[model samples]
Target: MTMTIKKQNRAAFLGAIALTLAWGPALSFAESVDDKIARAMSAAPSDVSAEATIMDVDGTILREGTNDWVCLPGVGLIPGDEHPMCNDAVWMKWMAAVGAGTEFSTDVIGVSYMLQGDAMVNNDNPMATDPNDGGVWVQDGPHIMMLFPNMDMLADLPRDPFAGGPYVMWGETPLAHVMVPIEAK
Candidate 1:
């Protein structure tokens, strides 16, 4: 009887595995194009996101826009988090550089909106994966980020996020940018 019970349990487990394998792809693809666009639009103001291009994490263009902005599903090293962001042209190049591990420099100012907030990340190191590695980690809420051509402009801004208001993030790195918080985290 024990052997029969064990066999039945094995069959049940196999059935469960089969069901999961059959339904996984279908469930993953269930998110519609309209849904992706809506999620991407949540990153910025209605005026900017409404006409901005909506792109997915895999560079799939869900919606083409008439403006110079590109909205994505998320940013940073956080896993499984959907912190969408609306980025202007320069920010896009910055992101591309970050993704490719290449040097990035801009001659003009850049802007990125994350009104929906953002995931936790190291303030001084963009490549740092572990938050407890002696780096200042911050999870900002409803913020706008500005990138400058001149690094000297960031010399006076505070680097501490707890200091409140605008501060410098990744201050010691080439990817340094100003973090302007619009609301409390």
Candidate 2:
């Protein structure tokens, strides 16, 4: 009788697992993967429409283009924040350096647009434990981030409030990028 009871319990557990697996595809994707890729690519310059290549997070080809730009999803290392980004080849090269834990001088002026940012946290998330630990969460609204060709070029950008735009982000690090807030439609 005990053996029969154990077998029944195991069968019930397996049934539940099977049901979840069956429903996972429908439930996991809020939207189609192709739609997600298209949305991510829209953050880039429309002029590059014919020349831009887009790929999903898994490195699968979604749409083919002829330009030097690539795009991906990023929300400043934060979860639940949906900020898709499009970056030129120059910026992607810089990203490779960043990934290898090394720094490299920029060659061509690269640009990345994150016009869909949900929030711009004022500080870096140093403590990996708390993604939002660094500073106040400012809904600075939608914005575009720029990658300068020269590291020293940052100082040359307008710092005065009257300049009406541009702020230093990710301070005191090579991971820094310029944030320019824009009016979201």
Candidate 3:
């Protein structure tokens, strides 16, 4: 009986070692909380990101802040993509709705900052995952986004991203917003 117990113990120890060896590299690649906070803060200007709460893509709060803005380390469907953004309260509500796959509406204007630029996305369909899907695809650079209560107000804005200024993205959808480019891509 003593010999059998020793054998079992040795097997368990070996299994633990194998598990560690298999997973160690993946675990090491995980981002630290401090790193996530730093990346999130880079989404907006110093004035907004300094007092903005840092959050993960899964809605996990990484760091608490004093202001109404919330910053995120990444957004979009691209694997390993880091398109950080800082959003105000109104945009937060809109984001929640988007995540929950529900309709979103607001009575006031909302703002979001993506000073680090954004991942490539189909500007007409928020659900589009492929860039080559024959849709209007754009990869904006260092821009601010605005959402209004009435999308009808966007009727006059240029829908083309290369129009040289602010334009309407997702114009036909309820999630339509104005994209104000700050710098060239």
Residue pairs clashing, model 1 = none
TM-score (C-alpha, index-matched) for candidate 1 = 0.81
- TM-scores, all candidates, are 0.81, 0.64, 0.81
Q: lDDT of each prediction vs. the true structure?
A: 0.75, 0.53, 0.75
Global CA lDDT of candidate 1, please? 0.75
Question: Which of candidates 1 and 2 is the stronger one according to lDDT?
Answer: 1
* Model 3 lDDT, full chain set: 0.75
Put down candidate 1 lDDT per residue, 69-113, tens digits, no spaces. 888766533445578899987787676656555677887899999
Q: Candidate 2 on 11-93: residue-level lDDT in tens?
A: 35333322322211221247676776766766655775346666444334456656666665443234443556776655554
**What does the lDDT read for residue 54 in candidate 2?**
61
- Give model 2's TM-score versus the native structure: 0.64
Counting clashing residue pairs in each candidate, in order, gives 0, 2, 0
C-alpha positional error of residue 17 in candidate 3 after TM-score superposition, expressed in Å: 39
Residue-pair clashes, model 2: 2
